[model samples]
Target: MSKKSFTLSKIATLCAVALSTSAFAEQAKDKDIERVSVYGQHHKNYITEQADSASKLGITIKETPQSISVVSRALMDDFSLDDINAVLESTPGVTVEQIETDRTYFKARGFDITNFQVDGLGIPQDGGDVHGTLDTSIYDRIEIVRGANGIMTGAGTPAATVNMVLKKPTYTTQASASASVGSWNKNRLEVDVSGALTDNHAMRAVVTKQRSDSYLDRYATDLTLGYIAYEGQLTDSTKVSVNYIRQSKDADSPLWGALPLFYDDGTATDFDVSTSTAADWSYWNNDNEHIFVELEQSLGTSWFIRARYAHMTNEQDSELFYVYGTPSAETGLGLTGYASEYDYKDQQNLYDLYATGDFSLFGQTHNLVFGVSSADMNYQDSSLYDYTTGNGFPAMPPLEDFEGNAPIPTLEDAYNGSKVEADQKSAYASARFKITEPLAILAGGRYTEWDSEGLSYGNSKVNSSEEFIPYIGAVYDFAENYTVYASYTETFAPQSEQDQTGMALDPITGESKELGIKAQLLDGQLFATFAIFDALQDGIALPDTALSTPDNTVYYAAEGINSDGYELELSGRLTDDLSASFSYSHVDIEAGDDANEGKLVRDYTPEDQVKVALNYQVPVIEGLSFGANYRWQAKTSRVQSNGTIPTVTTQGAYGLLDLVATYQVTERISATFNVNNVTDEKYLHSLYWAQGYYGAPRHYAFSINWQL
Candidate 1:
């Protein structure tokens, strides 16, 4: 059988097995099958009760002393937020910078969010950018902790940390299938099967598969996800669990970079929303595999010893086309094409051994947690470029008549780019103490060692760093349902950008401080917070024009970059039949004492933003519900040099509106209809780069789901 056929066959077999088990479960005694509650997994709730992305203490969000936001599964389903970018866009205080169709960067509080975790395990990248799509089908919810997370993530930026919690198998057998059809010839199908594979509910498995087309020109994707877990009660005091996960994504005709927004004469260029720079043969593919093992032993009722080990691997392969240089507004005759092929692989092994217990100290019962965690990661990548052209790169046709018909260059004999190898290691520990009934304190520190040596485009690079980061926070409950919190944390981020001397810049180091008040209302179902934050960063890399490289890239360290911001957010159920999430944020960023002092920092990020979403159930019509989401941002501007002249690119303030309606067709069937960008707004997707793309116009999708 073909590879595609084999993949489909595996999905079908898993679905069949789940269906059969579900049927058998229906006949089994109700007491024999453990009933798992779906309130935290699939229910229509906007807020979760607890989060530990900032601190590994597994504390409640109200006690974490940081700005925390959660994107629940129900929200993703209602809005059809199948991609990570969409999910983060819905979150407060986060900016999704879509530089290309497949490449993206996330920022918060004037800094890049480089820390990302899967179920509390770190998944650090070389840079603060994401290369491939991260589907939300297999995730239960996403937790976003804003500010420095040095206690948990070690060396990283201070913007935020994202923790994606994956869906786990239930004790009882279940299966779900969905199909969707949308605008722009978009089509999607998804299947999920999860349940216990053993009678005792010890062995469980979750399998998911999704395939979809895009609204962009010449873009399509296919995804396959699988998860298996085994949990057992070895004795009265000892428990063990093991899990494995595999996910793969294959994208066709994905854009390597976006379109240039300016012409050679310093005039802005305009294009339709469907315009794409990708050649027909361009593609990007990636695969991720993970393994996890844990053992827990109870020393007493209030203490436990746990050990965890995780191994993960990420691999990517792609052949891409990049369009560079600006075309003339009249003739459109200056563009060129570069063809390249890339292979990348990253592997990580993590280990943790921790112990937690309550101890009596100073006549007060305080909680103490002492542990150590170590993570070792290795990265390797290589590239092959087409150097067969006489003028250095293949020239493209006029923009007025250009289609994705650029020549596919032969890359076998003209390869010039080659290998790279990098490694990172870290160890960390944290603790939480309860000083009194109304006050708590959290403190922790991390030590990290990182080194990288590589060759790229005939340039040899080597860099290494060793640093220790510290964290502290305090929470005080002054009222019945209200608390005041403060936190201080530091950040460390490595850079690969080179200065004018062709030497790698020093790592960035920063400090963050936050003061906030949190409240829980409506019987602890509603969550609200208002916070003011300030951060100072040093050794920030900035483009330097005094000197230039062959590739037109040069950077210098900018010191004393300050970011000041405030945010207000509300999330949770307002009434028994109504749920809402709302947020507003304002930020000001500037260079304090550098050569660029008093200048705006990363002005591409908006100064003010708002996001609102609400869902309501109709009382008059049973099984019918409606949801609406709106997002708005203030004007943003960036200065870019076109050839030898400086120019400005600006995007005025704009808002997008989306609506969804759902109805229950049967007890086990439901239908949902969604319309996004209801106003058909025409706007640039991002301004992070000089080259940009337009956001999708009005689009609609209808989906039907069946579950058992």
Candidate 2:
């Protein structure tokens, strides 16, 4: 079907379901065989006992056959996680890598996470070039579902999906404020006020700002974030809500790349954690604005329909300097500089409509959900400065005492990029069938159409239409508080990847299978999940070795890669005085599929990783609490390119420790202290094009929270 027809079909189908239900409302009696909640309220704690990210059916953690993690606001506050990156570090089975100070990458199960949602509405996050752009203060919780999410989100990977649930306006009056100070002259302030504006209307707004000097020399940051929301109850069973967000971030003298890996003598150079590759004249600034609106109507007591739409715009401008090449210990003559100034803007429109309700067949109760979603993204005019003309700057500079106060050069407009338009539309349906009191089966599918064209100096060469992805799962509660389940899901993603012959390759498809056991212990306070999964990425273009040419023009054929892993996690309150969130992840990925140059390591992802955190409320004291977090990862290895720069780098394994303490000063006031990298262990944070980015050294921050 065409893109428009695809979306229209979804809406038509969902509306049909609603109409049929309404028609049969009088004839059918309420025989509730299964009672489930779609989106339930969360309690105040560092852990969420249940979530619905993995399954739209609102299945409990013990019932969903997947690896899912929920980062609650209380957990974020306990860990002082002000940003996405910090919260991700505390989450299980996830890894974050920094390409620069702004652009970042997140990986799970040896694949990239290309799917993101807010309140179940797919957000068009095109790419996560900047990872920590989202503010945690504006969110109620973050849901991370590992493996494929094709059942709910279309055109993605089997890696994972991140769903950020925004904070809503409370009908009750609430207000809070916080102030913080930390090392490197870092300071932050935040204010949040929410209450009922009228009997049927409520409003909430959040304002937060942070300014800090970095551990790296010449690097500083100023960030401001704001969110405002209003909700109105039109009728007893109808509600409408709207929210807007504005985020502005400015990083002064941010690092475009990382420290040089090699010295003039061809030996690797190691620098202190305070080392910086940013020039004093470099800065990266970004502004993001988004508006979201949602409408909900209750079809009946057992069913509901929700419609949502969002518009987002992002603007970024940067004058960055990349300092590369290792300096010689004897001459310090190998450092080089590359400068660039660019402006880019992106805007997207997102829409989704869905309905969910319960039905009865053969004396058993079941649930059905149908939805339609579409996202259209447009790239406005963009410009980049030309650099091939000349450097005109020192190719070799002192690395140790490099203080870049050089005059900023005027920028010349290069090629003005063409307006790029991309869109994805999909229709999806899912159902849960209860075969027995303790056994249930879940199935879903999505049909999607994708299109893209008019890119910078390039046009759309590959697209897809009428592609259907399938999802299936089975859950059985063999005993009380224990469940065993398995699931299989698939996704399709169109790629711009070209073969060696410069021909655009076909799209990549991912299929994942998972089997797990979940347990609820300590009277439902402790939740633990153990899962084993294997995922395959197929339809990837691989070079044909038989017809290979040295000029890089070779025929290509489809190939497949396999990745399997094990995940074990435990979350929730261990005891009244103690709580913990921890997990261990291990993945084995293999590529090549016996084609071309043979199978080798496909990614730089670590094969083994473990994360543990504990929060203890002092039983002896009224308002004293302490916690610590630790993370360990195996070595990360990547193969260098062939030709003039063939080499290999295998970073050693490392572990990090963090500590936190909080004291209650009054009924509404509290103090907190957080120390990151408590052991001061230096490790590799990320790698980009053979460059190494080091982790930060020891740092401490103190803050105060007041609520009224």
Q: Best candidate per lDDT, number?
A: 1
Distance (Å) between predicted and true CA of 346, model 1? 2.0
The 10-residue segment with the lowest total lDDT in model 2: 33-42
Model 1: residues with Cα > 4 Å off, grouped in runs: 1-43, 198-204, 389-392, 413-423, 458-461, 496-506, 541-556, 592-601, 643-645
| Runs with alpha carbons beyond 4 Å of true place in candidate 2 | 1-14, 17-44, 123-128, 264-266, 325-330, 381-383, 386-394, 416-418, 457-462, 497-503, 541-558, 593-603, 641-646
Cα deviation at 605, candidate 2, in Å, is 1.1
Candidate 2 local lDDT, 1-708, one digit each (tens): 455555566567766766575533332245332334322232236666456776566456666778888888887887778888888877777888776778777778877777777777664345545533667899998989999988777888788888888999999999999999999999999999999999999999999999999888888999999999999999999999999999999989987877766655455567777777777988889899989999988765667778899998888888888776656758767777777776788888998887776677776677677877888887765555545456424474666677766446555746555577888877788888889998989998988877876656443334444579989999898999788999998877776545665666666777999999888777777778899999988876565667765754444556677789899998777777888888999998887645422133344677889998888888889899999888888887655543465556567888888899999999999999999999899877775346766788999999999999
Q: TM-score of each candidate?
A: 0.88, 0.92
Q: Model 2 clash pairs? A: none
> Which 10 consecutive positions of candidate 1 have the poorest summed lDDT?
33-42
